[model samples]
Target: MSEQSRGVTVTPQDDRYPGLVEGYNHRFTGRPEAVRLAATTQDVVDAVQDALDTGRRIAVRSGGHCFEDFTASPDIQVLIDLSPLAAVSYDERMAAFAVGGGTRLDHLYQELHDGWGVTVPAGTCFEVGVGGHICGGGYGHLSRRDGLVVDHLYAVEVVTVDDTGRARPVIATREPDDPHHDLWWAHTGGGGGNFGVVTRFWLRSAGPRPTAPEHALPRAPRRIRRADVVWSWDTLDEQSFTALLRAYTDWHEKNSAPDSPGRHIWSNLIVLHRSAGSFILNSVVDDDVPGAAELMAEQLAVLTGPGGAAPAHVEEQVVSWMDTWMPSYSWPSDPRGRYKNKAGYLRAGFTDHQLAAVHRHLTDPGYDNPMACLVLTGFGGQVNAVAPDATAVPQRDSILKASYSAGAWTAPEEDELHIAWVRRFYQDVYAETGGVPEPGDVNDGSYISYPDVDLADPVRNTSGTGWPVLYYKDNYPRLQRVKKRYDPRNVFRHALSVALPS
Candidate 1:
């Protein structure tokens, strides 16, 4: 191991090599020649320069929460770890909040809220790093009210490789006339590892620059009202289950308009397999909103209507926003467990046929994993107000996002079983679209934040539509142009990264 002002470089012979080779997901482990622990932006630049000079493959990792093997590929010769660069502060020069790309969501949220009483609409997973999250159009509980994280993104400081193979930092903003504006646009939702390494992000709401710190971003809610309702599998027959799902979907579809009263409400329905014993519906809303309690009760009533089964248990609480956000509500990462996740953007509620398929898969006796589940997350509202082409995220009109996932296994032998089950389940649900969610009236495609390699596989995604179309929709071409301009040598790429124009 060699230590320098830039950072520490751990070679294969170093003791740190073993720990740095693996990430959050235990499924993939890399055998890189060296690991560069970048402590500053200059460290990143030097690391990239070294890779370019040595003709070695390189990859970057922030919080190491990547779902796939993008950074953990075996072919990677040098891994640049940015976790050491974590920092969050307001940048008066840029009139925006400057967040280190390596900063975790939990750290970002606490700093923004405690320091300025503001926050961004990002993902619920607090461990997620801002580097990839913001670039992939991050969204969560506040999305329906404020819009996606990228919607408020002001500028990004990325280290790009020029045509001459020289690595340098470039600052790109949302300003239309800015020469590097396309670079900023591509990061909005084009996903990470496609353009270059993002060292810092400047965040401020769209519109005139705010003179005061408090006025720069959306105000953090004073308090939040949360409810978790669960229904036992025994009480849910096919009819009741289908009715419950339909009720939740219909309510969101009707109330997800930009100006709707229900915009303050955010919910997620986790439909676990029968082996899990019960399915759960978790909802939250700003307690400061008028009739917040009443709205919550009404939504519960709709889901547990006469036609559907009554909830077996319900838990409700009101807590300060800081209390709710801190300590990270996301499930702790299990180092031994492997995970697989597939996602799609829903333009509307699932049809009767789709609902039936969901029920069949959840109750299938052949599949007994309690960890297998499908999740429907509330979306739209202010998000849909943006034009599809306004940002790299083109599925702005989607009402809900569906995720099919399976995990909780420790043995590598169990990978095939769990993966096959989810693949079959997702395929069956979208059987009409050639085993995948193709951009259409009901399905707007998938979320890049929840990247799935299956979408790029011809045998799995028989939809004929390529992965680029499924994720970027009509924005793929523009992203490619941006890719060609910034990464002329394709220095940054991965399994599902943007392809150069033919």
Candidate 2:
């Protein structure tokens, strides 16, 4: 295939190849023979078709924030970079906001709020790509109030290869009678890179769209309050530590009901590894609501507990909605470098045993990565309002979502140490469930966006459950069917991509 046919193809010898192949995680390097930096939907279709014709393994990248090396694997020979196709506009035909697959969260937020005074409940990281995030049921601070980003997704434009080995573009909408409705559901949460390449997403909530543009989607929050509270590691003994955790979880359990007033608040308790010095609880709440301050104060008191004093450090500030969200909300001091992440959901508070395991791992002195931490973020609320089978994302009853991450590796030799530390930590935490979070009493399932390839390994996933079953639950079978229909040739696939069902 010629470069003209594929839009813009950069060979390994090209100067742009280095930046084109680089993703958020610097640990793993992608060395595709050529990179197709797509500038339009037609460009993506051309690139995929050309790769298919040439018998080249293809990988797709948007904002390049995939936690795993799914987009950066050595097996890939052609990478279709969608970052240059960032565009957000109102689609009169669909009567919804259309966002290009490569649009970043920050750009999307600004365009939606400024142009339309509306927004989708999306990822916290400003630089995250919309394609993979929404496809994997993206959620963030506004999620508790407005629900998952996919909940607003009305339609998707995708390029796929059929049984004839022909690549074509199709638009799938949520309308019941739409012939491609199944395709739309698959993208809701089937996880990215399984069925096809998503070129654009049209977002509009289920109900009717009023005549006004602002009413098309959920209105942007008037104001937001940010609060931070920290407890020194020295101040937390095992007893206080466990109490603090229980307090945080207990509050979520009570307030996570679909209609709870506490739904206005979103927070994450960052239980930093001991090397970080202090563990902190950061929260954001809708400042326009009544009793917002009182609600935050109440939650803070519960977290501190009866015996424990106030947080050693506390700061609260009110900022414009755009200010809190537009700036980088990424947690790490150095997020652009090496990192590994695994994710899981909790239906209830962590058991005493689980809490102890977390304490043990966080306090382990032998693991010296300062940036290593286990983050438990508040979930549920409006998210649980939808039925489990309503969309492809099945974990509707989860109260909290937890992520295990380790980063900032100084050298390649240090990679094993960081990996071992995080793996051991996760395995011990879920030891009773055979290593990883198997769907059961304590663990609901895993989040697909986190995409941990380790879960597919027999050595790492002693969970007695396969990776797909853990991530998709009963939704896996349906997703497999969609995979068979949309990607019969299986052109868009990776190590953990959905298997073609027998």
Candidate 3:
């Protein structure tokens, strides 16, 4: 569309590409075909159009956190970077915040809180881009109380490809009469990079849903009383391992409900496999509720007071009365790393024998690290009550959310082990549970939030189920339709990303 973008930039091109990545924003060292720091929505559209015209393999990098190198791949020539376009604007009439796709959670948090005393429900890591985080049904500390991030999406502005092989970059808004409404629907929990480059999003997600108190989304308790549960690896036997896991499972089952939230209870941020020696479990309570610390103590007594001696490591912190949680509150000490994670949707609470299996895996001296912890996120509040056909992400309220074990090292040597451990652990756990997809898949659905290409990988997983059903469930078909209407040529294609029928 412009004479200036006729050929690639004359910048020095780094001839070789290895695992070339940087943690900070200014890390594009190699001279790419062209790296246009897009400053506006129109710039993004122009850059995409130019790439299409030249028939170049274009890569989009926002915070470059695709861990799998989705941003700058092994063979990408042109890169349309939205990193320079990070900006946040508040519009009073919409009562919404417009966020740049390249902006990270931390930036958004500061801008929103400092400027408006409001915050978006997002992952715990402050670094992940808001776009990808929301795309995968973004959830966080506020999840038990608030639904996924996309759950409150007001609209989006996307740069897409039309049927005639033309770049059609327009703001796809969520409206009853909008023709591209399907695009808006897909944007809701359809996973990022599958549709198009979302320049910005208008979010309508609000905290404190209006359900009855028992059903109201769990908010941050007035005050938060935090405590840790630590057990040394050398101190336990096989039976101890089994009992520990069983205790966790049993406690989760018996105390995982309406009462927990009313009492402002969240969960034990269990640091399982020790990277060093013994791991830790960071647990929390309603700091607002008087005697909240004592209450958590009582609960722990009921769960783990048996033959085990006092915890080998214990730490506690107590804070303010207001209740809230930040982004994906997680286990990884290093938020930025090449990593792959898989998830399972849970229905029934795991049984004792199953808990024993869990212990075996967790206590495996080999599985020493916080990454090895099975993150058990609670999922029973308003999450389960959504109407099935309402949005694409269809895991409407279940009992608990299960994230498979292992956070591997960043070094290439440890990469294989980390991924292998996660995959094998998930496989074995599912084997004990029945099969991959777990017999009673929550509402016959899974979440798109935790993306696992394994579902589509015939070698590793033989679930026969495609990525759509695993994440979108019945909503997959609609997403395909949205993909068709918005990006007919399948321009925004990525591994584990959704594609429309040819």
Candidate 4:
């Protein structure tokens, strides 16, 4: 067998492979005994097939954004890094964009928006890879107006290893009647890298199309309202916190729909900065400036100031919605910046007491990180109106898809504490929202893209919710079937990957 690097290889590990490294994720890097940077579909297939034949564990990296170390873990000896396999092009016949799985989300945006004038309902972060990004039912600013990323996904090219340890690449389309129809469903939101190593994706036909003006995509929105409201941990008491949660919840329930005149031209970045030890409420809405700014000012005023305009970052923008969103957080239009992330979906908002609990957690300041922010993104509109069975992501009807994370910390020691804080916060705030999987009144089903390996571990995510069930919901079964069909030997097993049922 070919052996390279410091680790021993049971199978023939190509010592010449240059991509092998020690650390890989945005948060933690992974060192692999051998790393193969595949340039073609054949390479991906061979990597999978080799891992199966040699009884070696394998992990795939596209944008290195897997919240956990699933793809970037050191325990993973053989790594297949696909970030270099990226290539995007337009298909005249399909009228949809053919995007490589390795391509970054923002790169696709630049191609579709700047080159084509079209845009996909994708993640806000430009660096996120389209590979695993869309597979987890990706959502972005456009989600409220359009839908999640899967809503616009038309097809995918994937490589999976069967029980015989033979890797086969399959091209699955969203035809609904195709032989591999179930495979497409599994890819929609089943979580990437588990069922197969997807090489390319076909955007939906009826969805956004690239044009020259925007690049062939939908023209950027003309005017937008960028706003923010901050509350000190000391100021937001239990009653006020509850009122804030209720206010947001009520606003969403009262005005959610693609065609609603009161459509939210908004995004709330609920932040907890350990350094400052304060919570900043940031928002940006796409509504009639004069009308919405006033109406919204009132709705929020009840919970915030006595009256007057919103404080800090408060203003209505008349430029393109695309540009307006860029400066909301000084998040430049660049994807090269590396990031560490964790996300959660609120089936509902927090209760009054729960808000107070969160305030308390933020104030205690257990971890010190600059890029720390608990972003609360309101989700619900055309995306949620669809049924869970309809796509790979089932948390469609979520009232708020919140993202809890502490971005960059130079020291490895801080990772455990920050991550621990998010998980614990999720647990403490869960009871207020009822939590997930059950029908009664639950709202805490985590996002697969923002994977928390802790959820899969009995000791970490003691919430009793399993990985597949929490991430895929009822769709977990189909994902398992696909896993068995492609990766039967379980070569891709990771902390949070979908497993073939015993």
- Report the C-alpha lDDT of model 4 over 194-281, residue by residue, as the tens digit: 7778888888534354442334233445456655566554555445555665666666666566555345545665666545545555
**Could you give the candidate ranking by TM-score, starting with the highest?**
1, 2, 4, 3
* Candidate 1, 113-142: lDDT as tens digits: 999999998887877888889889999989
lDDT of 2 by residue, 1-502 (tens): 2345336889989877887788888887799999888878888888888888889999998788888788889999999888777889998878899898888888999899889889888877877889899999999988998889999999999998999888888999999999999999999998888888899999998798657667789988878887889989888788888888888888899999889999989998888898888888888888888999898888877777583435789888888878654474654324458888888899988877799999999999788877899999989999999998889999998989999988767577778889888988888888888888888777887999988988899998887799998899999999989999999888888878999988
lDDT of 3 by residue, 309-428 (tens): 346876677764232333324323353445666777766656554555566676666754565667776555555546656777677645667777455455656666777777877766
- Candidate models: Cα lDDT each: 0.89, 0.86, 0.62, 0.65
Q: What is the lDDT of residue 188 in candidate 1?
A: 96
Worst 10 residues of 1 by lDDT: 1-10
Better of 2 and 4 by TM-score: 2
**TM-scores for every candidate against the unseen true structure:** 0.97, 0.97, 0.82, 0.83
Model 4 has an lDDT value of 0.65
lDDT value for model 2:
0.86
Candidate RMSDs in Å, in order, are 1.7, 2.3, 5.6, 5.3
True lDDT of residue 275, candidate 1 = 96
- Lowest summed-lDDT stretch of 10 residues in model 4? 1-10
lDDT of 4 at 81: 70
Residue 1 displacement (Å), model 4: 30
